[model samples]
Target: MIQRISHFFTAIVHRILPDPLIFAILLTVVTFVLAFGLTPTQPAELVVLWGAGFWNLLAFSMQMALILVTGHALASSPLVKRMLVALASSARTPGQAVMLVAFVGAVACAINWGFGLVLGAMLSREVARRVKGTDYRLLVACAYMGFLTWHGGLSGSVPLVAATRGNPMEKTIGLIPVSHTIFTGYNAFITFALIVLLPILARLMMPRPEDVVSVDPRLLEEPPTVERTLSPDATFAERLEESRALAILVALVCAAYLIIRTIEKGFVLDIDTVNLMFLAAGMILHKTPMGYARAIGTAAKGASGIMIQFPFYAGIQALMDHSGLAGVITRWFVDVANVHTFPLLAFLSSAVINFAVPSGGGHWVVQGPFVMPAAKALGADLGKSAMAIAYGEAWTNMAQPFWALPALAIAGLGVRDIMGYCVTALLFSGLVFVAGMYLF
Candidate 1:
């Protein structure tokens, strides 16, 4: 039955899902229409909003691109590749391969989303290379299913924000600690459930042997080493480029900085730090500045989609936030919700709003003000309410391809290749999110 449902959704997505760029464009149109109709914002203002907000994510776009480049470089390093290969070799069958990829992706993303995205893609590629007869598309989708656990994990933005001082909701709900938000009994159930069950779900979704879409072994070949023998009398400039000493020195410096940062802020991670860590590690593992640089050059081609498509989603986020449409949507859910249902409804509303604002930090900003005050008034669990919003954002990402760009770029697959399976995951995981919010 699970396989049948997976097959059904896969077929539907293949038939209906357009290119991710087109999907983003279509989402923009839908957001425009919804915001215009639902809010008092006029057409002219909406136009300015869209155009003005289009460039808002330029910095974020750069970070994402770096994640692709740096992460690819790191994964391509001999040490990392060997590690991934060892893990991939553990799975003897396609089912085990799919399950392993899902579990690794979940654990990685739960630790840090940026790290998770790149590792998941790289691991999937390694798994595909070693696991013959595995469905390549299903492997990628299973990797992405691991993303659902992120918002409940240590690095989850909504929970982190709720726990922080002077957040927008700080005055209303005060500071809800991580113990209440991320470390709670209910959250544990949800995160553990997804971590444990999603792999099983992915295993179930595996296509039959004959039906499997196997990738070419040549395509999965490890990235070539950048190191090459230099002439005895190589020029100083050329030597500097390949200088292993320089790479080691730089990596050590970065290591010290990161250690200091960890000491100051515990384990808090953001995009820039993650990128730097990957960059430093890649440089060290590759054994030279030039080697890591060459690896980055090869990996950069994958970032083209991220560079072109993020602006469209940024515009949608602006339209959703500035137009008051996101707030209005949340209000609708809050209006219909009582104390018992507030968290569930908040999760649902965040799930809807996530289509426009597909970002973790962005979701908290858009949904926090409304959900926090309402939870306070209704005597609801503020920590759970915040988590509900986070869960919603993470849950719907399986349907929203906004976050999938990194994984797809690295895996060398199109959105359609993995989306059908992701849609299946989206449907199946909805039960976990709902149960987490209301039951525990």
Candidate 2:
């Protein structure tokens, strides 16, 4: 009877939400209610809930603009096709192929996660075709391995640090001394190393083909137009180029963010002022309601989990803050830990949360308050602590189901296949996590 109830709830979750975002949100709310009461003793404190709700909307709206544009730009490229082909040609074994796909997925995600999602989805399909006798599952897994690890890469984490700029905590948590340049370069190097090494590792753990069924050969066949045609009327390339309208919209939004950031530093707008300004900016900049509406819709589709979960986390922190649980938790962890353990915990927490709550921004929203205070109290490498959070969020991204949906859809594979490949990717990721713990 209990098992039946559990299955029933799971079925409902899959039906209504059909994604991790809602799940994250529901879990957060449940945890918050369990941890705190239905109401705070001071009704005025409810303002925190309002503040968190706005933060969720604003942050997610911004993320949608970024992801949509990046996805369109990266997906339309012929280079993505070439990269997929090159990967297919290079790998000898099923495992090797999976690693290559994952590496590429990570690269795509690092460069731009929005792009990573679309690119991985499209490329995984191509790989499925090439591995004539292999199950599409391996390719799907490869895509997610890359999809999941992306937060640790440059594009996602650096922006967060940059957002904080020269504030006290930002300065103290000097994870990337050179800021964006160093962060991207370091992440790129890590991405490259993973690309090279992951395939070799996959080759060792690859399961026999007898256990997995092969896909249809028709799926592998390249279209005649792919090889043959150029048209004067309107080339395929032109159609592809036109699709970049949304991408341009997104780029402009990011540019606006940078511009606002400059103004913010020059004038020192308070958080509330900044929020209002951005809200106004979004309203003005989007112009047509449909464009902004589309961006929001897309974001809502992708980031509902982030939207719901972040506030719950905020509430959790608020409970801790108001009730003194956070202080107690911090003191306990600090008292028990040595310096070596702190970094390890930072990495572990990051990995665990990344899997459960995959968005970097959302994770940071909750983690920043808790981790920041802990870092100050514990005397851990503050910069490294920040990076650890960033890194942990990124490392587990390689396996997170939150990111697997797109890849699975594109590749015509199941989650099981992707999870299988992730098993191998996680082993190496663990090693990297340990190294980061010690090195930083």
Candidate 3:
């Protein structure tokens, strides 16, 4: 029955979903019409909001692009490839491969979301290469499914923000500790539950042997040779470009800086930090600057979707924020919620808002002001309320294509290829989140 349901959604999504770029554009159009039709905003005002907000994510876009390119380059490094190949070899069967990728992805995500995103996709592709008859699409989807645990983990934006001193809600909530949020018994239970269940879910969703859509064997082959021959009389610049020592020197510099920063700040795992580590690792593992550059050139092709689509989503976010549409939506949920029910309602509200504003930090800024104050007024647990928003934003990401962009790009699969399985993940994980809200 689960397999049937998975396939059903897969068929529907594959049939209806357009290219991710087109989807982003359509979303922009819908947000524009809704802002004009449902809100008091005029067309001109909406256009202004869209234009102003379009470039707002320029820095963020660069960070995201780096994450994908650097992560992919790191994975393609010969050392990393050998590691993944050895890991993939342990999975003796297709079902085992699914479980292994899911487990690794979940654990990595629990440590840090950006690390999990790239690592999981990279590992899934490797597993597909080794595991004959594996459902490559399902394998990639399972890897992405592991991301569901991120919000409940250490790098969770909501918990980290709430734990920070002098945040806008700090006075009301009195600086909720990570102990109260991320390390709580309820969150621990949810995290472990998904870690265990998702792999099992992936195994169950695997199609019959004959029905499995395995990866094309050729696609799993090693990247084409980019090694350039160097004569003894090679130019000084050519020697520098291909110098292993030069790459190692740069890698060492990055490593030293990262170590110093970690010592000073204590294990900060933001996107920038993740990118720095991956970049350094790729440079060192590739053993030459030119080799790393070649890998990056190959990886850059995958990032085109993100490059084109993010600004549109940024525009939608701006329109929602500036047009007061987000406030209206949040207030509607708050108006209908009370002390006992506010957390659940906030969770649902965040889920809805996540469709437009996919960034966890961004969602917090928009929803935190309203949700926090209402939680206090209604006598709800502020930490849990904040977490509700966190879980909601993370929970609905299965359906939202925004966060999946990096993983999808790495997997070389379209959104339609994996979202069907993700939708199933969304349903099962949603129950866990709702249970955590009430039982915890």
Candidate 4:
């Protein structure tokens, strides 16, 4: 029955889902129509908002692209590849492979979203190389399923921002400490539940034997690096290009900076820090600066999807925020919610807004004004209220192709390839999120 359900969704997704760029374009049109019809903003104003905001995410777009490039380079290191191979070898059967990748993805994601996204994709490919007959798409989706817990984790933008001083909502709710937000009973329940169950759900969603789409090992295999043997009389520039000492010097600088920074401030796993760590690790592990550079060049090819599509999303977010469509949509949910129901409703509202904003920090920026005020008025738990919005954003991402871009790029797959299983994950995980809201 589970397999059949998986097959059903897979069939539908494969038939309907276009390239994610097309999906983004279609979403842009949908947002325009909704804003024009539902809000008081003028059509001319909407176009200006889109254009003005088109470049808004340029810094963010680079960060995302680097997340893919750096993470992939780190994973392509020889030591990391051997480690991945060892981990993959632990799972002999297809079922074990799915479960292992799912669990690993969740844990890594919980630690850091960027790490989880790339690690899961790389690990799944390695697992596929070893565990023949595992459904390759399902492995990638299972890895993505780890994302369900990201917004509740340490690097979660919503909770982290809420805990910081002078945040947008700080005036209203005061600073919500991590103890009250990320480390709370409810957040733990939700995160723990997903971490524990997502793998099982992934295993259950495996396609039937005949329906399985396994990848060829040759396609998944990395090509050998063809560095020529250097003569004893090699030129100074050539020697410097392959210098392990130079790579180690740069790696040490990165490590020293990160360690000192962490000691001075706090252990923050924001994108910049994560990317630096990946680059540093990759440099050291590759044993030479040029080898790491070659790895980065190879990995960067997968990142074109992220580089090209993010501006459209930025435009969409700008339109939704500037045209007041996001607030209008949030108000609809807020109007129906009371103290007891605000958490769930806020979660639902954030889920709706996610399609438009499709960002964690962006969700907080768009929904925080509307949500925090309503929560205070309705006497809802402020921490829970904030996390509810985070949960919704994270939950609905299973259905959205925005965040899936990084994982898909690394997996060498299309948006449709893993989305069918992701839909199933969204359903099962939705129950956990809803139940946690009710209980905590």
Candidate 5:
């Protein structure tokens, strides 16, 4: 039954869903029409909102681009490739490969979402290479499914932001500690449940032998690196570009900076830090300046979607923010919610909002002010309320293709190829989230 359901969704999504870029474009049009209809803002003003917010995510887009390129380069380095291959070798069967990728991706996401996004996809490709007859699309989907645990984990943007001092809602809610939010008994139970159940879910969703779509073996084969030959009389600049010494020196400098930052800040893991670390690792492992450059060139090809599509989503978020549409949606849920039902309602509302504002931090910014005040007035647990919003933002990501771009780019698949499995994940995990909201 589960397999049938999975197949059903996969087929439906494959047939109906367009390319992710087209999906984003359609979403932009839909949000524009909705904002125009729902808000008091005039159509002219709405156009301004979209235009004004279009470039709002420039810095964030650059960071995302860097993460994708750097993480890919790091993964493609000889040392990391060998390590991933060794790990993939342990999965003797297709089912084991699915479970292994799912488990590793979940754990990685728990530690750092950016890292997990790239690691899971890269590892899935490697696993497909090592384990014949593995369903490649399903493998990538399972990898993306691991992202569901990110909000309950250490780098969870919503909880981490709420815990920080001077946050916008700090006056109303005060600084809720991580213990009450991320590390609480209820959260622990939810996280552990997902870590266990998701793998089993992936295993159950595995396609039959004849139906499985394995990766093309040629795609797994690494392209041979072309070295520019230099005579003994090579120019000084040519020598410098090809020098192992230059790459090692830069790597050492980055390493020292990372060590110093860790000592000073006690293990801060932001996107910038992750990008730098990956850059350092890629340089060190690639063994020469030219080799690292070549790897980066290879990786940059995968980041085009990220570079192009993020601004549209940023504009969508801006439209929601400026046009008062997001607030209206939140307040409607609050108006209908009782103390007992607020968390679940907030969770569901957040799931809707996440399709527009996919960033966890961005979601909290818009929803926290309204949701936190409502929680306080109703005497609900603020911690759980915050987490409910967090979970919702993470939950709907199964259907939201924005966050999946990096993973899909790395895996050489389209949104339609994997979203069917992800839709199934969305439904199954939604039940778990509802249970967590009510039971604990």
Candidate 6:
């Protein structure tokens, strides 16, 4: 009866707090109250500034949410799944699937971290469906392999740009320049080796199922579905093209604003500018200006909720910074640890810290203040340190509970399954750490 009551309450919370947006609101309200106590400055004074800054921050949050939603829509389609299956079918064994997925994920992440979540999940599911072994645990493990490598590749915007915000390494290492630090020979070698080594390790670590259980015929029964005769008059392509107009318009406006902002400000423009642009584009493309307005209203109905909660997360960052907790921790890492080994310590520090703070931006924001200074002081190569931090952040995602949420949902797998696969990845990534130490 007690367990039943507990389960009922859990279900109720899941229903009521159905999304992160809801969590964001509650977090913000609590943060607003807590912020009053954290800062040395008075509440009224902080409020005046926070009031001015809050809108822009909220706009950024909304933009992040939109991009994530839009990306999910694009990647979750039937066509992409078909492509992934065709590719995975070539692999003969479960371990091969792990390597293939990890390589693809690393390449994609090398290109863009945001895409990593979608690409990894979609690819893993596709491979799982095709492969003989569809144990939820084994498949979940395969999916996260890609998640591990994605950080070191070209696609990761976080690592490529984090140091640009205020990295001293950018200044000191003026002689050895490249568009991406991780694109270097050393980082590339480590990334490639891990991609290759992880599968072999997985093969050893994971034993094949005792006996393959044939799936039940009834469980796999075909659904009664309609078959469409060829429509000579109508084409899906034509319909897709017609619908493409709105999507294209929306994409162009967002891209234009992003480009303009990147050129002027050196990174993507502030989040509000991008969100407002999308909102405006949505309005204009609709039947009428009023239609556009209504669309914006509907799309942004959740913005208020997000605004309320994100500030608290922000407050968490602020408290850590103001209380000197993050610094003290960083200081300890610097003082006691012998970092003369360069990439090794860099990788280790990155892996450990990433477990606690899963965000590249947040990790950079906190660790950057102290790490860059310590690296210079130790006579360690700055670029290597920066890349190490980036690599570590990405590498550790293999184990981060925060990032595992999406993979868990997509694979219908539990935490235990995800962790099981990552154990091998952890061993493979250790090679990356050692390689980074010696080369850099």
lDDT of 6 by residue, 349-375 (tens): 667666444566666666766776677
**lDDT (CA) per prediction:** 0.90, 0.52, 0.89, 0.90, 0.90, 0.54
Clashes, model 6: 12
**What order do you get sorting by TM-score, best first?**
4, 1, 5, 3, 6, 2
Model 2, span 295-387: residue lDDT tens: 344333333333444444444444434543333443444445566687667666666655434666655554656665676677765556666
Question: Candidate 2 regions off by >4 Å?
Answer: 1-30, 37-96, 158-168, 171-176, 179-193, 215-335, 373-379, 412-417
Candidate 2 lDDT score at position 261: 74
Tell me the TM-score of model 2: 0.61
Q: How many clashing residue pairs appear in each of the predictions shown?
A: 0, 7, 0, 0, 0, 12
**Angstrom error at residue 269, model 3:** 1.3
Residues 1-440 of candidate 5 have per-residue lDDT tens digits of 78889999999999999987888899899888888889999989999999999999999999988899899888887778899999989999999999999999988999999999999999999999888889999999999999999999999999999999988899988998998899888888778788898999999998878889878776677856624567999999989888879988998999899899889878888888899889988888887788888888988888889888999998999998889889888888888999999999999889999988999999888899889999999999999999999999999999999999999989888999999999999999988888877878
Candidate 6 has a TM-score of: 0.65
Model 1 global lDDT (CA atoms, 0 to 1): 0.90
Provide TM-scores for the models.
Answer: 0.97, 0.61, 0.97, 0.98, 0.97, 0.65
Candidate 2 displacement at residue 249 in angstroms: 13
- lDDT for model 5: 0.90
How do the residues 260-307 of candidate 3 rate in per-residue lDDT, one tens digit apiece?
A: 988998878898999999998888887788988998998898898888
Q: How do the residues 274-339 of candidate 4 rate in per-residue lDDT, one tens digit apiece?
A: 889988998898888888888888888888988889999999999998898999999999999989
TM-score, candidate 3, is: 0.97
* lDDT (10s digit) by residue, model 1, range 1-440: 88888888888888899999999999999999998999999999999999999999999999999999999988888888899999999999898999999999999988998899889899999999887889999998988889999999878998888878878878767899999899998999898899999999998898877778888666676667687778999999989988999999999999999899899888668788899899899989989888888999999989989988999988999999999999999999998999988888999999999988999889878888888899999999888888889999999999989899999988888898898889888888999988877777
